[model samples]
Target: MRAVIFRLMGVIVLMLVGAGLVGWWFGPLPAALVACAVALVVIGVDTAAQLRVLAWLKWPRHDNIPTARGVWAEMLYRAARQLRLWETRVAHEEDKLKRFIEALQASPNGVILMDASDQIDWCNDTAAAHFGLDPKRDLRQHAVHLIRNPEFFAYMGAKRFDEPLLMRRNGSYGPLLLSVQIIPYGEGEKLLLSRDVTQVERTEAMRRDFVANVSHEIKTPLTVIAGFVESLRALEFSIEERDHILGLMQEQSDRMRHLVDDLLTLAHLEGDPHQPAEERMDMRQMVERLAADARALSAGRHRIKASADAGGLRGARTELTSAFSNLVSNAVRYTPPGGEVRITWRVLHPDYGDPYAEFSVSDTGIGIAPEHIPRLTERFYRVDRGRSRESGGTGLGLAIVKHALLRHQSELRISSQPGLGSTFSVRFPLARLDLAKPGQAAGAPDAPRADRESISA
Candidate 1:
């Protein structure tokens, strides 16, 4: 405004000077007209220059005050750029997190994520399946509400993040052994991991049962041996009586020894599941030796027979011998006084296009129930505890067979009907079986001898 006023004043001053000069040089009318035209031109030119300056001033400078709309537009652009960068970063991070969560969902173990407020923030498919939860709907719910176990609830309520909680979850699927762990994450967040340990728990239970069964088995044998020892010590007897007592003690001691040996064999087999297969043993000779041992162990109480086609197996000789011996011994032990035990070996073709050495020990003894067949390989599981004791069984024979079969990558199958006797077969994979040397015969010379007198027929 000040500059505009100064320009106007200068224009007026110039007009007065021009009018005076014109009047001095010419007549008054002509001078006046000339002065007015000159002043008007000068004023118009000044006004136009001032208007240009004002237009330049109105255009924004680098550091000049900006219009409200301009400032708002710039702010909005920066905000949008920042938001785009943030959104991109979030999407990238979310994609990575989604892959990690998908992997967790596919894992066999159950997993759950909880927030700082002890609420279930997220859970994988396995965890949802184990808990029988609706994955889409149950998010953000309290974990305690879903898993209603008292122990787990107490553990979560106590804020004890250090120790994991062990509990059982009963769901529509079945009972599941659950191990729950809670960990503190960033800021106020928490992470929870759950694992189903049902199989492990079952194995532990079986171990406990085995220990108890062994204790009971050993106690009974020791009691019998102790009673006989006491009886011998209490009375003065003839040479025949003394010999009889010593023989009985020897039998008890032998039974104990056999039991201990079997237990040790089972332990050894379990320790090394992947033993080297350097030795190729002849199945025919092995069966022969086993039959001889079985016959001798039976003591003329039962007839024994051996039959085999042609097949040798590659495995630890000592382990294979122990396994075959256990099978034959089990058969002989279970067979009645006049029953017959048969050992057979043949090459079998399975549906999986694999050749296997099928070795079977069939006995005319009291058969096993169908329900009990599955658990027969478990340590110390017995169909007839009293009969097993009377027959001097340690109850670990089949257990040893199981471990041995596992080492050989073989399968043990037991089929029996009550009173019809049983057949226990161990099928060895072809990879583990080797043919005997060309010169060697398929059958052993020391095959079991069947005595007609001991035959039930």
Candidate 2:
């Protein structure tokens, strides 16, 4: 302020000196009038410069201020410099805000920013989806009114965030679960974060059910064994009775063993992914072996026929045999006496031009319901629990088949109708089909009567 005052005084004095020099050539009266006019003109010019600077302040687009004299010029230059600093700060803050919003937009989980009163301030697409909100339309709307979940509102309203809130959205598969957490910040502003936990919850539930089923399965046999052991220990019995008890015990033990083996096989199949076998195995031989096992299991109860033309498969020999045998055994077990179970093996060329080795087992017995067909491959799933137990099935046959086929890059396809019988088919990809060996380049041999055998135990 002092510098401005000094500059103004110097300008006034300079104007006075000019006016005095001009008036010295005339009289005293003219000198006084000329000095007054000079002062007015100087004041008018300074006013005009200040007005221009004022206009620039209102709309400061020019890079530099207009040229002027005295304090008005200094004020204009200083004002433009200060405007530049303000612009820089404003730009920095705006860029930071933009990046923050973009980060929220890209986040996998949902995020919502709410003001002090729980009004929707801003939200990303994920958050919008989480709460079924429209980004633009729902701005400034109350969250509770929009989401309408009492539990969610209670969670946020309580202002106690010791644990996250769990909510189930409507119209989702098995109630699509969401875990939400609220964080309060900046004078009652809140950040609401949410994540989908439906899969995790489903897995946990499946694990619990598996443990329970396994425990029950084991307990039944253990109880039976304990009862028999007690009977043998406490009371004297004839040799026949002892032998009968022993036989029952052996059957139970074998049942348990089969269950454990199936469990182990499943564990091994699910453990790791590896390269498939390069060596080809005679699929015809494998089908014959499966047929033999199925006949033994059927024990003349069912009519069985085995036919195969497919050559070989490029996969773990044991896994392939296990899967094929399981399907054949299941057919035999489910089919009643005199029912026919036919097995066929052929190479199928789909419309996509890819060939698949198809092994299918069709049974003429009580068929599976449509609803039960999809879950037949799930562990422990059964069409009829009592019938499954009576048939000596471990209930893991289909699951093992499914997993084994997965390992071989194949798939299991099931078709069935109630009271019309079922067909369990496997389609192994061409990649896993070993065509012919170098020495046997002529191609695979024809399946004769001996290869396609039909016999009952």
Candidate 3:
């Protein structure tokens, strides 16, 4: 301010000096006129500088500011500095907002933002897919109008956001379950969040079924044993009759024991996280042992045969044997009298993939229907509950097989048709298989023809 005042005073002094010189040359009236004219010229120049500042203000660009002198120059320099600072702050804020949006997009759960009027302001990609919404096309659209789930629509209208709502939707594979919740935020705005709980819900349901099945399975045998004990204590019977009653009790006890063992096996399979031991397994010897066990169980009721063209495998011997034995036992149990149960181990060289060893059990039993094939490996699941019980199965055989095979990085494939036959096959990767020498095969003289049922699991 002081500099501006000094500069103005200097200009006035210069004008006065010129006016004095003119006065010295001419008269007092002429000198006064010259002073007025000089003042007008100064005003004109100042006005033009002000207009230049105004023009720059109309379309301000940091790199292209109009040059000026005196007070306007100082003002323009300060204005340009402030503008650059503001631009930097704005760019920083924009970058932060972009990063925040990207984090939401990468999130597994779904997120949505809505306005006070219940219109969708924004939603992440997961949220859009969860609700079948288009992020851009559905902007500002009513939330209820887009998501057609009755429970969800009512949930928004009620504004009772304390508890999350479990919503079921039909997915391409099966039913999908979502846990959705809304939270009140700024003013009347709301944040809708959703999580896919399909696996969680299924696991919970399976737990319930497992508990019920275990209780029932145990109770039936306990009731039988209790009845037999009461009969022996109260009723008078001959030695033969008593022996018979005691034998029945022992059978029930054995059944309960077997069930307990199977339950323990399944628990171990699920709990253990270690990979199957990388020990070489003699496939020839294993196949022979399985065939022997199946024949003993069959007791002349079924024709049992075994074949092996592979030498050995590299996995936990116990786990591999248990998994292979389950399939063979299941085949023997399900086949009727004179029916054939054939087990084989052969190398499979696919046209497009690496060679693997396949161990298959083909049985001419009352094969499973297509509907029940998928659930065959589920614990205690049965297509014919009565028949399954009569066969003296613990019902956890296939479930154990599934976990064991999975631990070995192997897969089980099932192909079966109702009444004709069923084939349960296990394919071990080349990494775990030891190929046999050419023409060196064990067990049955000739391999049984492969069964090609329509359904596979």
Q: In TM-score terms, which candidate is top? A: 3
Question: Which model, 2 or 3, shows the larger lDDT?
Answer: 3
Off by over 4 Å in 2: 1-20, 27-42, 62-89, 172-174, 273-279, 350-352, 437-457
How would you encode candidate 1's per-residue C-alpha lDDT over 228-303 as one tens digit per residue?
Answer: 8788788789999889878887887888788888888888878864675667777667777788898799999998
RMSD of 2: 4.3
State the lDDT of candidate 3 residue by residue for 1-457, as single tens digits. Answer: 8768987897799789878989999978888988888888888988998999998888888989988888888999998998899899999999999999999999999999999998999999999888889999999999999989999888887889999999998765677898998999999999999999999988999999999999999999999999988888899999999999989888899999999999998999999877655776677677888888998999989888887764668888888888888899889888889899988888777899898889999999989899999998999998898888888888899999999999988899999998988999998898887654335453325333342111121
Cα lDDT of model 2 by residue, 1-457, tens digit: 8878897787789777876887788767787887788778877887898788777778886565678776777777787788889999999999999999999999989998889999999889988877789999999998889988989988877889889999989633446689999888999898989898888998999889888878877888889999999999999999999999999999889889989999999888878677546567877777788777878888888887887774677778888888988998889988889998888888665788887788899999899988888899988888899999888888889989999888877888999987779999888888877656334553467455454343222
Task: Estimate the TM-score for candidate 1.
Answer: 0.69
Candidate 3 has an lDDT of: 0.87
- After superposition of all CA atoms, the RMSD between model 3 and the true structure is 5.4
The number of the candidate with the highest lDDT is 3
Residue pairs clashing, model 2: none
Model 2: weakest 10-residue lDDT segment is 448-457
Query: In candidate 1, which residue pairs clash?
Result: none
Single out the weakest 10-residue window by summed lDDT for candidate 1: 448-457
CA lDDT, candidate 2, residue 370: 87
Order of candidate numbers by TM-score, starting with the best: 3, 2, 1
Off by over 4 Å in 3: 170-175, 349-352, 436-457
